[model samples]
Target: MTEPVAYSTVWHVVSIAIVFLLGLFFCVLIGRKIGIGFRFSVFLYLYHSFWCLVYFWYAGMHGSDAFAYYNQGLLGIDRIWFGSHAIVIVVSFLTSVFSLSYLGVFLFFNFLGAVGYLFFYSSLRCASIGSKKWVNYLIFSVLLLPSVSFWSSALGKDAISFLAVNLALWSALDFSRRMSLMYLAILLMLVVRPHMAGLLVMSLSVALFFDSRAGTLRKVFLGAVFTLGAVFLVPFALDYAGVKGGANIDSVMDFIDKRQSITKGESSVDISSMSFPVKLLSYAFRPMIFEATSVFGLAASFDNLILMFLFIYGICLGFWRKLNPEYGNIIFIVFYLFGAWAVLALTTTNLGIALRQKWMFSPFLIYLCLSYINQRQLGRLK
Candidate 1:
C-alpha cells in the first residue's frame, strides 16, 4: 500500500494545469477576437511562459518581491485596493480560492502579460496594415524582446502595469469607440500606481483639448471631464509619489533628491550631478554591453542596443515629421511617453529599477517609431 499523495502537491499540480488551460483558451479566444493569427498568439503565449519560468528561476536564486507577496497572500490580506496591497489581495484570492502554488501565480501573471502583448501586437498590426515586410519584422522583433516578457511575467506590479498601459494604447487607436477600456486601464493603473493614472489622464485631457478633428462642443465636453479627472488624480498622485509639499519646483526637486539618495545599491548611479539629457539617456539606454555585470544585465543591454538603433533609425527617417497633429491619440502618446520618461529618468536612480520601469513608456515609443516606419514605407509605394 502507498501513502496518500500530499494534498498540497496534488493541488499544486492541478492548479498549474488549470492555469495553463485557461491561458491557452484565452490566448485563442482573444487572438480570434483581435484578428491576430491563432498560431502567432500561441507562440506568444508559449514564449512568455518560457520567460516566466526564467523569472521564476532568477527569483529563486536571487529572491524577489514576488515571494513576499505570495507569503503575504498565504497569511491573508485585509485590503483589496491601493498599491502593492492590491497585488497582495489578488494573491490572497488566487491562493485561497484556487489553492494555487507560487508557480501557478507566476503563470497566471504570465497570461496577463501575454494578453498585453496581444493587445500591443493588435495595435501595431492595425497601424502597420499597409506597411512593408520589413516593418512587420521590426514589430515582431519588439514583441520578442526578452526584458519585456521577463519583467512582466512575474507576480508583481510590472505585469499589471504593462497590461494597463497596453490596454490604454489599444483603446487609444480608436478612442471614441473604446473609451471604456481607457477608463478601465486608468483604474488598473490607479490601483497600482496612482501617478501613472494621473499622467494618463493629464495627457489625454491635453490631447482632447487640442484635437482639431473633434467639434468644439465635443472637445470641450471630453476635455472638461478629463481635466477634472487630472485635477483630482494629480494631487492624489503627487502625494502617493512622495511629493508631500506639492507640485512646485522645490517639492519636485526635493522628491528627486530624496529618490536619488535612497535608491542606493550596486546598480545605483549619482544622477544628481548629471544633466537632464544625460539622465534621460542613461535611464533609457544604459547598462550597455560593457557596463553589464550579470546575465540579466547583459540581456537588458542587448534590448537597449536595439532601442538605441531604433532611435537613430527614427531620426534618420524623420519619423517625427510623419506624426499628424490632427490625430489626438498621437498627441496623447507623445505627451504620456515623454512625461513618464522624464519623470522616471529623474526619479529612478537605480539602473535595475530603471530597467523594469522603462517598459511603462518604452512600448509607446516603440509604437510611435513603428507607426512612423510603416507610414514611410506606404508613402514610398504611393
Candidate 2:
C-alpha cells in the first residue's frame, strides 16, 4: 500500500510538470504575440538561474520539514487530509520528492513562489513612478534582499505562501471583471498556505469592503471567507484538539500567558529568558550587538540601507495614495503591509529576515510612489 502510494505520487508529479511546462510554452507564445519586453525576459532568466543553483545543490535530502516527509514517503504514506484543493495534494506529494534531494526541495519552493513574483512585478509595472532607468535600478537592486534569496535557497514554506498572497491580490484587482475564474483562483491559492494566507484573506476582505460594484451574492462572499478562515485556523484548531507532531500546545499557551503577564508595558526582559522562542522575540525587536551575540539575528530591522530607503518611500506613497479618492490600490497595499507586520509580530525566529522581509514590501512602496509621481508628471504636461 505504501509503495503504491509513493509510485502514484511520482506519476502525479510528472504529469503536473508536463502540464506546467506546456502552459509556460503557451504563455510565451501569447506573450510574444503581445510583445513582451526584454527586461522581463532578463528578470525571469536571472530568477531561473538562481533557482538552477539551488536545485543542483543537494544530492541528499535536506530541509527540516523535508526530513519528516522523507521518512513518511519511504514508508509509503503520502497523503495528508485537507479540502478539495489540488495544492494540498501537490504540496504533500512534492514533500515526498523533496525528501529525496536537498536542491530539489528548494527548487520546488522557488517554482511555487515565482507565481507571486509574476503578480508583484505586474503590479509594479502598474505603479512604476520613476524613469525607465530608475525603475530598472530599483527592480534589480531590490532582488538582492537576503530573505528573497534565502527562501529560494532553502526548502522553506515562505516562498509559496508569499506567492499565494500575491495571486490573491492580483485576482482581487480583477475580481469584478471575471468573478468566477478570479474568485476560484484566489481560493485555490488561499488553500495552499492558509497559515500565512492571512495576507490574502485580509487584503481581499478590504477589497470586498470597498468593492461596491462586485454584484456577487452575499452568501457567496460570506461562505468563501468563512471557509477559508476556518482553514487558516486549522493548525491551531488541531493543536487545541491535541492532534500533534511537534508542539507542546499547553506549554505554548502557558508561555503566551506568561509573556502577557510580565510585559505590563513591553518591559521585563527576564520574561524572554523563559524559552528559546521568547529569546527570538527579544532579538526580533531589539538592536543588534553584532560582536557579542549570534542568537539575536541582526541588530535592527532592514539592514540594507538603499533597499530600506526605497521601501519607506514607497510605503509613504502608498498610504498617501490610499487616502486619496483615486486608484484605491492604497487600501490593498495598506492591508498587505499591516498583515506582514502582524505575522512577524506573532513569533520571532532569529533568521536574519525581519528587515529582509521588508524588501518585498519595497516593490509595493515603489509602485505607489511612482504612480503618484507619474500622474503629477502627466498633469504638469497637461
lDDT of each: 0.84, 0.45
Q: Which 10 consecutive positions of candidate 2 have the poorest summed lDDT?
A: 291-300
**Predicted structure 2: clash tally:** 4
lDDT for 28 in candidate 1 is 81
Compose the digit string of candidate 2's lDDT tens values, residues 215-277.
578646754774576456645533442335523677556544543444433322332334554
lDDT score for candidate 1 against the true structure:
0.84
Q: Please name the candidate that would achieve the greatest lDDT relative to the true structure.
A: 1
* lDDT for residue 36 in candidate 1, whole number 0-100: 81
Question: Model 1 clash pairs?
Answer: none
